[model samples]
Target: MNAPALKSKCLPTYLVIDTSSSMKSHESLLNDTVDHVFDVVGNSPRVAEFAHVSIITFNTDAHVVLELSDIETVENLPTITCQGTTNYGKMFQLVKQRIDADISGLTHDGRRAVLRPAVFILTDGEPMDKDWATQFNALTDASWRRRPHIISYGFGTANATVLGKIATKAAYLATDVDKEKEAIVSMLTSLLNTLVASASAQEFRIPDDVPGYTRVPIEFVD
Candidate 1:
């Protein structure tokens, strides 16, 4: 019998961020974190050469702050703001729509490609949105052809159990609340490095550094 074949990849990466009021306390740090992440991902030759980056910032409402496209100039990304509540439902639904659009646009006539859409969501509080389970399930099930890779992180008393549920795997936690701002910034940089590195190699692994990084109970299964 033939062994399973390796799949080809051209994964278009997507970042779904949480910019809720809970982040207001760490607004300055959050801004720096996002800025740094963009730099890390956009500046890397591997990511810049092959990956299309899309950024989605969510609060009480979800919005597509940026769409799927090659980021030739990372500086061109609009400055994101934080306000409103934590509505995971809005975020999941909006992202699902965008994923659909991307898959819909793909043409089989092109090279053999696998578009792995990845999402990285960071937050510091509980969700304020109702009926989030519906959208969350739809996204985590991997029914979409783009098959998303979602990394959700929580900090400062966020419900690890709940966030973990949304993310498929347990969510990572930035446990240093007293220094939560800086800690989150560090995680952002680290995660971006992982994303870009994966894009460049066309293959990747989670927790590339081999540190458990305080991820949630759901992730413990791994």
Candidate 2:
């Protein structure tokens, strides 16, 4: 007898996360930002269907934190604690690896080739480790660069100059860095909502290359 066919389903996927500390005074909201994303994706049809998600977190160290999975179980999204300093180089590398690993599984699962994963990187502080530039270039190598859309959003007065460079061409400053948690949540909703829509798609269209305005709109300059 033949074995049952594995359920074949398309997956709209992306990475959403917070960057290093911003405005040391308000650094405690990083986990809230991640939780807000989970709540948004968990509740939305745009992201809940076949759209899977992964999370990466960085502060003094970088980590994959979460793996790609359906939003149904997304409530288990880990708490992102704030400690140490920023390590942009390590964080970018972690992101690259996560995507690369998932690509293999997607190919074998009879799933369609993916749209460039949308990466929403929200940060309020700078990388404590300066090797970030070299790491950024390596991760931005043509392969990874072409495969994912990285958007850098700064909150609580994060340095726009820095966020701009990380996001490449697409970057924005949050409306309120002091109250960055709510701002990050709104940004996460737009990103996940779009990703959910993308997953439900038959063919991957480069999603709107623009950042949808959020609860508190920030001046986006790239």
lDDT, model 1: 0.68
Tens-digit lDDT string for candidate 2 (1-222): 985465445453545454444434444555665566677767875556556677777777787777877677765666565556666877887777777787677656656445456566867666677778777776667755344666776666467668767874366666533455566656666565556556566434333433432222223322
Model 2 alpha-carbon miss at residue 11, Å? 5.6
- Clashes in candidate 1: how many? 2
Which pairs of residues collide in model 2? 21-125, 22-124, 22-125, 46-196, 47-196, 156-177
lDDT tens string, model 1, 28-101?
Answer: 77666666667766666567655667788889788887787656665566777889988888888888888877
lDDT of 1 at 58: 89
Model 2 misplacement above 4 A: 1-16, 19-33, 43-46, 143-146, 176-178, 196-222
Q: What is the lDDT of residue 101 in candidate 1?
A: 79
Q: In model 2, how many backbone clashes occur?
A: 6
Q: Residue 155 deviation, candidate 1, in Å?
A: 0.7
TM-score attained by model 2: 0.74
